[model samples]
Target: MPAITPEQRVLDNLRDTLQAYVAGDVAATAVVTVFRGQAPALALPEAFQRVLDELLRRLEMADVFSQDSCSFSSTGIQEQLGVWLDKAEARVSARTA
Candidate 1:
């Protein structure tokens, strides 16, 4: 069995955090608790951080668009995150490969 790397751990944490956030636990405390003491262990490259920041910004923009369209839905946001994750995962794979 291969050992899990720090990137794997952080990615798993991110998926879990996104799930919890979508499942009505959207609170600052919940988010902080998810990353606190967990995220600092990784020494991810700056490119990876930019990928994450892009995900965040994309989601924020999606939320604003939803508000403007009057079609706000958590599931829509989750789907947006899913697309962002696919893109980010591809970026990471390309970087690592």
Candidate 2:
């Protein structure tokens, strides 16, 4: 089996962090920190970064409201994060391949 790349590791961590945040085991800031801290390691495209930033922004707003206010559903954001993960993994794999 091919060894996991650093980008893959970062992506996995982000997914796990998002899950933990939804579970209330982690703070919203911590989740944002994980994304910001590890983003460089992923070497993501600018498009991905922009999308992530938008998601993080929505996440912060969601946290502030602490409910499905302003149409910012934490659950919806989490689902978006999952989709982001899928696309990021594909992008990373394509690059490596």
Candidate 3:
């Protein structure tokens, strides 16, 4: 396999985080919690962080979009995350398979 670009790495990290959430991995949950707490101070490359941030925002919006009333809720967020993770995992699996 070719080396993963920085942008790809950011996407992969996001995907992995979501996968961990879907799989109910405690470690992943803890990591995410910590990351969220520290996200404001974490010094990441501008381009990489920009893409990741945009992706996250889009995912959050998608969560609200999935609701019948177009409102956001914890349930909507979880559902959206699940759907996004599933699709991402499938894409990764296809690439590797």
Candidate 4:
């Protein structure tokens, strides 16, 4: 088996973190921290990072307010994160190939 690259490792961790958050096994802050902490290692495009930052910001906002009080939708943010992961995985695969 080919060895996994650092970017792939970070992406895997992000996936796990996202899953944990969705399962309510983890907190939003922990998920955000994992994303930010692993971002540099991924070295993804600036555009990707910008979107990620926005999602993280929205996630934090959602976490702050109760569901009834918050306009921000945690479900929407989670869906966006899933899309981001899909694209990131494709990009990394292409880059490493």
Over 1-97, each residue of candidate 2 has an lDDT whose tens digit, in order, gives 9898888888889889988988989998898899888876888889999999999899889889975776799889888988988898898899999
* Candidate 3 per-residue C-alpha lDDT over 12-37 given as tens digits, one digit per residue, 9 for 90 to 100: 66556666655657343343453344
Expressed as tens digits, the lDDT of each residue in 44-94 for candidate 1 is: 556555654554544555456653363445466567656655655565556
State TM-scores per candidate. 0.51, 0.90, 0.35, 0.93
Predicted candidate 2: what Cα RMSD to the true structure?
1.2
The alpha-carbon deviation from the true structure for residue 13 of candidate 3, after best TM-score superposition, in angstroms, is 1.2
lDDT of 2 at 6: 81
User: Judged by lDDT, which candidate is best?
Assistant: 4
**What clash count does candidate 3 reach?**
0
Q: Please say which candidate is ahead in TM-score: 2 or 3.
A: 2
How far in Å is the alpha carbon of 92 misplaced in model 3? Answer: 17
* Candidates, ranked, lDDT: 4, 2, 1, 3
Give the Å error, residue 83, model 2.
0.6
Backbone clash count for every predicted candidate, in the order shown: 0, 0, 0, 0
The superposed Cα distance between candidate 2 and the true structure at residue 80, in angstroms, equals 0.5
Model 3 misplacement above 4 A: 1-3, 27-75, 79-97
Q: Weakest 10 consecutive residues, lDDT, candidate 4?
A: 66-75
